[model samples]
Target: MNWNQALFPQAGPLRVVQGEARREEPSFFPPTHLELQLQGAPDAYGIETTVSIYPLAALLQKYPEQTEGSVGQQVKALRSLLENPAPLNTAAAFRLPAIDTVNASLAVAGARKSLSSANLRGVRYLGAFSQDVRRFASTDVRYVFQGISRDGRYLVTVNGSFSGNVLPTRESLEGSGYDVAPQPQDNDKDRARYEGEVNTYFAGVNSTLDQSNSNPEVTRLDQFVELLQLR
Candidate 1:
């Protein structure tokens, strides 16, 4: 079941990032990954991953017509969402096709990161938008759930972070004063920055999913799925 409409009533963006932001405010883990690395030696033995709900604009861009069985060719498929000013896709509405595409993408992407929902134990969808940019005042709402692995093991963890932005698009982000245009960099500074921001947001959502403060936030910038696991 989809949680977008059910959890987000006041504003799409707020509802999207609320839960995730709360988790990330202190850098996801209570003590932060750096502390964990120094204290628990997690780097010696621990895996982390993160998962987030696609923004409405991203959904529209990637799955405009609900095409299936293929990756790429979707709307806004990796475009700079933070700086773009594209209109939100609230009118297009989230559909099964889009959801399917997202799930498929998740499955493939998750596998690449050594994670999958088949091992999902539970999930809490967190909204992300402009409102909770700081998350000083808000409530965390739980949305969506899938049974854990029959072996009594939570194969994967999922945090449902949403970008409360009505429909995140390139035009929308650019209007918001974010540097989202594509560029070339051998050092990949722009790519590094983008990954950092995305990871930061994703950590927020994952931290919430591990509400009790059990799982550790990821250390490596690339291992987002470290906050997410799939059996």
Candidate 2:
């Protein structure tokens, strides 16, 4: 099932990350990797949504020798999904291909996110992630999820962000003009001033990290995940 079309009246960006090379590790093959970007609520920063779906049979048909024999069997291949929460923390990723290509979005915030054990209706061993970007006028943080379906038929991922926040990449600090970009002719004093500004900005983000306030978007997206039915 193509969730992009089903979830949105008009979906966006479902590419195979062009120039993808077959990595040395078959487990890191490229078939299970994908990309997308969806515009979401206007208020949330970097809150656009993007979901990637990869069909397992498509993987097998393309690389039968590389996939696990049992999973390749297609009839009883669901064993890959880790259901038990105890060992879920140590579980490896869904064996989807590695994303090694470059993307063209200029980012400002650190590529830091908090991850914990999580599961959606259609998938198990899913990891929930959130980034701290000094959210303003909105409780929404950039939430993301990635894991394989319970039946091992597909790999599913969800990144809640919108077209409004897609460009400039780092909505937290870069595009906000709080920490001004250093000019090519910046002197030592100018560099120090910019560094101080960035430090202050991150301190605010750290304060958010210390708070325990709940994000409503996480629950909303979780329900969306639970309702997804992947064949």
Candidate 3:
């Protein structure tokens, strides 16, 4: 796979690491992968940008979204979610990949939500997530585009971490419309209510990520993926 470097983060030097990709937990089998990083940012900034591509079988759980099925069925199901998303769909949340290992639960690792396609490959899910949702520790909030190849053999993800875009937090939720209570609610009912606000926040984040430098308003990452070719 050859990617366009110009589509990557332009702020600093882009670090390229190409080789096998691992899962959250070590596996006897290793999958081929490529990772692109933007250096010179603080820990809070996280990976300014990352692109991960790997074979579907590399994961301990082969299903794209941890669903039980054959590879074709799983790919169909994952693609269906992006194609026929529910109201304010967050399906992309289930598809985040573990950068280091193939056996991680990407769905629950961080707080994430997504809107419909941002358009690249067959599907480009415009997604948002926190590096550490429970702690709200990092200033970095990621906007990602995840998809599979037309032939259904690969899973590719492009992610960018931007600062100061934390979604609603327990403390911040004090007066965050969904929970105007003097103190944020701690019960399951509050969680149900807050779900709407969380999705709404991701929608806004998607809009911001949709824009990019230079003319025509297309994100460089999107532009880069536009030219992505895998053999």
Candidate 4:
């Protein structure tokens, strides 16, 4: 019962089949989408007011006649809309000049619609690749690539640091055309500068986080405890 010979029959000291080559993809992932809606502005005298995306949409739908408001106010309003979600109908209600510019940028950047099922006429969603980058850059996010052997498995982890206070480290491998190894100083002085930027981003976003003791670290610890209990 020579099982090895039976499985891979080749006489005269055959070669062992090892790693499989990866299939080449037709295209890479699409870019992330960023649709911003700016609204609000000051009056002739200098009074300013603003509204959320939903409310702004309502205002736009309700009051299409008033377009000669403050430019600054409109910009602020549009920026707010991009962060917050509003109903499609609400978003359609108001028309702003910023949409054309933003959409133009999106087109140039190769951004795509979020959904394949329904129509996304006025909403904005980032591409899968962009979303992935954002998720990793959010806050202390880490990436782990896992592989297995017959006897054991191993994990390769890339721990992301904070940039700008609360934001996660962000990097892009696109547009360079090829991969290049970093120089030694590129790993230290440059790395330090990047980490510093992350610290700043996080600091700004920390205020926006839920005002609870339930930070990411706390959540991760809870998960670890639960896994331990299961074991």
Best by lDDT: 3
Q: Each model's C-alpha lDDT?
A: 0.27, 0.41, 0.46, 0.24
Candidate 3 lDDT over 1-231, as tens digits, reads 665655554433323444444345334233555555533343643555666666655543533444443343445555665555552234444443333323323322232233222333433433333332222322324445556665666677666554443344434544444322233378887776666555564455444444422223224445666677665
- Candidate 1, residues 1-231, lDDT tens digits: the string is 122232223212212223222232212211111101111112322222122333333323332343442222222221212123232211111210112123222200110111123323222222222321222112222121122332432222233322121223444455564432334366778778766765564455444433422222221211232232322
Estimate, for each residue in 1-231, the C-alpha lDDT of model 2 and write its tens digit. Answer: 344245455556556654244555424444645665645555534345666666656755554563342224321232332343343323232232121211211112222222323333222221212232222322233444545665556656676642212223344444465323444245888777766765564444434432322334354455556655554
Please tell me which model should have the higher lDDT, number 1 or number 4. Answer: 1
Q: lDDT value for candidate 1? A: 0.27
lDDT of 4 by residue, 160-210 (tens): 111112322333323332112232254678877656654453333333332
Ten-residue stretch with the least lDDT total in model 1: 29-38
Off by over 4 Å in 2: 2-29, 32-37, 40-48, 56-81, 86-141, 162-214
Candidate 1 has a TM-score of 0.22
Better of 2 and 3 by TM-score: 3
**Stretches > 4 Å off in candidate 4:** 1-21, 25-165, 168-222, 225-231
C-alpha RMSD by candidate, in order: 18.6, 10.2, 7.4, 26.7
TM-score to true structure, per model: 0.22, 0.40, 0.51, 0.16
lDDT of 3 at 215: 23
Which has the greatest TM-score?
A: 3
